[model samples]
Target: MGKLLENHSKNLLREAGVLVPKHVVARSPEEAAEKAAELGFPVVLKALVPVGKRGKAGAVKFAQNAQEAFELTRELLAMTVRHFPVEKVLIEEKIAIAQEWYLAITIDKKAQTPLIIASLKGGVDVEELSQSAPEQIMTKSIDPILGFAEFQAKELWSELGLTGKPLTLATQALTCLVKIFLAKDATLLEINPLVLTENGDVAAAASVMSVDDSAMYRHPELAAMVQLGSERTWRPLTDLEKRMVEVNELDPYRGTARYTEMDGGEIGFLCGGGGGSLLSFDALVSFGGRPANYSEVGGNPPERKVLGITKGILAKPGVKGLFVAHNITNNTQVDVLAQGVVQALKEMGKDPKIFPVVVREAGVNDEAAREIFTKTGVEYYGDNATITEAAQRMVERIKALEISGEGI
Candidate 1:
């Protein structure tokens, strides 16, 4: 779930012996015009935002002279799209593309393998093409342990019907792309507009994307790049996220949490792991319940960490209900989690009668946790309860209190 900026993605491709267009980053219109003049006419001026679809958003423009370059840069500098402000512009020499194609390497979560996706049509939405005409796209999964073999890459090139130098270049590009994907531990590596130049030379006209936050540990350089981008954007990080990042630096082997704050709603979810959290969130949405935030107290988390996480979740405004759901696992202690929840409630000076809470604890020490909840007069569910059932019960309880006009 990590995303790399476009500049960094292009740098990775350049390091793999791919011929990318000569480019320069300009912080102002004057610098942009200078760079465009140095690179010659017909340069592309792109707004340097981390997100994609810049062309569709009018964030990318072409300049045939210095005046157009300056004007475009000035217009883009103050523009913001998708909540991201453009601070810099990339100026590059435009290539004469005779033909275009697409290539990408990414992990398939369902298949648990590396997937290679390519298409004959490029510079457009591949998803749209697939939906309208899937015959133009080619896809294959590769075993990470074996890496991508040369023969497999050759077969893919043949399937695309590319011949001669274009075929050779495409095969080489695929091989190098796979190497970069594996070497960087990237979740996604995409190259759109894998262009064939009018002179029959192959080059990458535009690199679309890449993301490799997991591999930041093994690549200090990549980690530095990530830090730089994060700093530039001035994104606000929650206390839990900052602490988790610090802990990850100290001990890379421990389980991690990906916490992001969202608009507050009625129910607060404390679910287990990624998949279970997503399931509960989707179920709550389907049952007409809005979640306050997405929080996953990972497996075997320390008691103090659990306490801190609970406190953080409860501190948000407009949280009327709480759902503590965990799947069947052997390591985590349910009693410890219960203690954290109880402590957080006490600190907030809130009464269970006013604030409704639902608990669905299963697995290790689940019985003890249920007993604790009972002693405190809190509602609790056992191991066999379905996720939908738990969500429905919470919604019903909240609705009842709403009907009564309770102050929660």
Candidate 2:
């Protein structure tokens, strides 16, 4: 889940040969006014932010003249939509739309396939349309492997009551859009208010797009437009979060190391595996322990990757104790993990004597894992203790440390 801003989304559509309104980027109200004057009055001024519902948030406005454009641009620039402050404005020539339609391509997570949600009605909430008039909207599931064809697109529009030249034009637009969706490995590509101009030409008036972050490796061209790992936050990444991203990307390949900072907590959580991380977090919370940060470290990571993540977890303010856990690994070696954790603790000058550190890992090379951890003077457990029991032990250790004010 990686969302592209409106300007980026429009750029993608234009690159794919889709018709879009003539637009210009403006960093200030004066620039927006100048662009409005150059493009002629009656323009749309939209805030350049990644989050959605800009219209409802007063980030999207219309200006009928240069003066109005200048004033509205100032207003848009002042908005903070979904915690994202406006830094730029997109000024575009307003299209005289005769009709509006909706088209979107996304995944049906439950069905595990690409799906299309299209409707004859547009410029309105898709959810409202679904509830108000379900007959006017159609949901189509796409065969991701075989792909969507031009004929399939044509038939789709034709069924929605489009005919003649409009039908053909809409079909071509849909075909091109589908190609962009699949080729880019996008999670979402939606054209709301896909307008039919008064002159009877089809154009995409607005678009919202998000690509799969896991597939970003295959799309170097998108690097400049996308802020990698932006899917997790509505606002800009905090300094600590940015550092964590650097740590993970520095490795590129070897294993996974992901970290997300929490608001506030006392325990630093370093868990492994996708499922294991979630279970660890839930178990900690269930045992009345607050984790300062959430981390996922797995896939048989090398010492460097493990140490990088472990240090990050413990660096968060107020994190006095560390809780590390992972499920029974299939391929991940517990010894390698133990080495990384111990090295990070030593580098950070953390001693189990003062700082409570609990590790529960049992997998390949468990014997070595136990030995390394115990030698480091860190509390360690193997398969004998369930993950839940390990979580309890970590909580108890932290509580005793807090009572004694040793690490506080």
Candidate 3:
């Protein structure tokens, strides 16, 4: 998923009719100091990195004068927190906070539903507060189809014990936040410390984070803000990622592939559909095997797309073993996936015998897929094999090959 920085997040909020502070982005310390002077004293300077815990990492600072602003700007610009180098800073007018709270709308992948999390306690770690005082956090799940109605937001405000204009302001903010979350196709939209001023006005004072990688196509402006440095390096995408992103945008009804690279042992996975992936991951971990990547080729993906996905897994480095496992209830063909795997290996100039591939396809077309794998010289397993069994088999195969000093 794509992570938006403070500036990009603020733009989305402002577009949704949420009241955010007047702010300017400065590339240099001099520019930041000048912007702070223009905005007046007691300004907040935040490093423009697409990561959370900036405040805890000392990436966020306050300046009461132009001199302090300049100093803070220089320090932040040169600082590297969590491996993300700060190149720009946001200078915003400091709002006088009367109260603080949390508000967020996100899709619960397990529940397959939209969820809203809120708290009366603001301007602090919600997790920390929840651990120390569990009663403060309020959470609700919303139907994706029905969404958050106005009454639902109002009821949330009432439950928080907010009164008068502040309640109205909060209700309005909640409604707008929901709209923004839906409109942007966001996976997560969080506003930590949604502040209420003494003047009875609501403002998003701090910690505005959003993850909306899916909506990048519709919002070119937001896509442009995705930083091209270490932020991308962590889960480095290959040429396939760029292609799949384009394919995702073109196909309205196609399944999505969430591909992220990881370092470790062999045995690349193509699992998931109704928590099977999670189970497989845990089983792999239990077997002392580190996955090469977390790649999910979702339900009913076309044979060609499956081929592309297999190619992606093969392209990954240190992936000397392959595990293609899916649940029995899933309606994907075994032959389609096996064909993809064989084609990818051939195109990459790798032999299945040398690479040690394992296929465990169940559900529809399982027999045909098993036959295909057998003919292609790839190891095949049946639906009766447990997750741990499949993982152990793949890991053992890799270990066998490694000990034999085989070249692939």
Q: What do the candidate models score in CA lDDT, each in turn? A: 0.77, 0.86, 0.77
The TM-score of candidate 1 is 0.84
Q: Write model 2 residue lDDT over 1-408, tens digit each, in one string.
A: 667888888988999988999998998889888989999778999998877677888788899998898888888888887877888999999999999999999999999898988888998889888888999998888896898889999889989999999998899899889889999999889999899999999999998888986677788898778755545545677788778777776556667788888889999999887877888899999988999988888777788888888998878888888988888887778888888888888888888767888989888998998999988788988888988999998889888877876754
Question: What's the number of clashes in each of the models?
Answer: 0, 0, 2
> Residue 322, candidate 3: how far off, in angstroms?
2.0
TM-score between candidate 3 and the true structure: 0.85
| Alpha-carbon TM-score of each model against the true structure | 0.84, 0.94, 0.85
Estimate the TM-score for candidate 2.
0.94
Name the lDDT of candidate 2. 0.86
What tens-digit string does per-residue lDDT give for candidate 1 at 237-286? 55555654453343344444334556657787788856777788888888
**Whose lDDT is higher: candidate 1's or candidate 2's?**
2
Model 3, range 1-408, lDDT digits (tens) per residue?
A: 677778888877888889998899999889988889999889999998877778899988999999999999999999887767788899999988888888878788799887888988877887798899888888888887888898899998889798888888899999998888787777777888799887779988764555556556687766676642222354324565665555444443566555666666577788867488877877777877778877777666666677777777777777887887877736666677677777777888777777877766687788888888888788888878876688788888888887899855
Model 3 shows how many backbone clashes? 2
Error of 2 at 225 (Å): 0.7
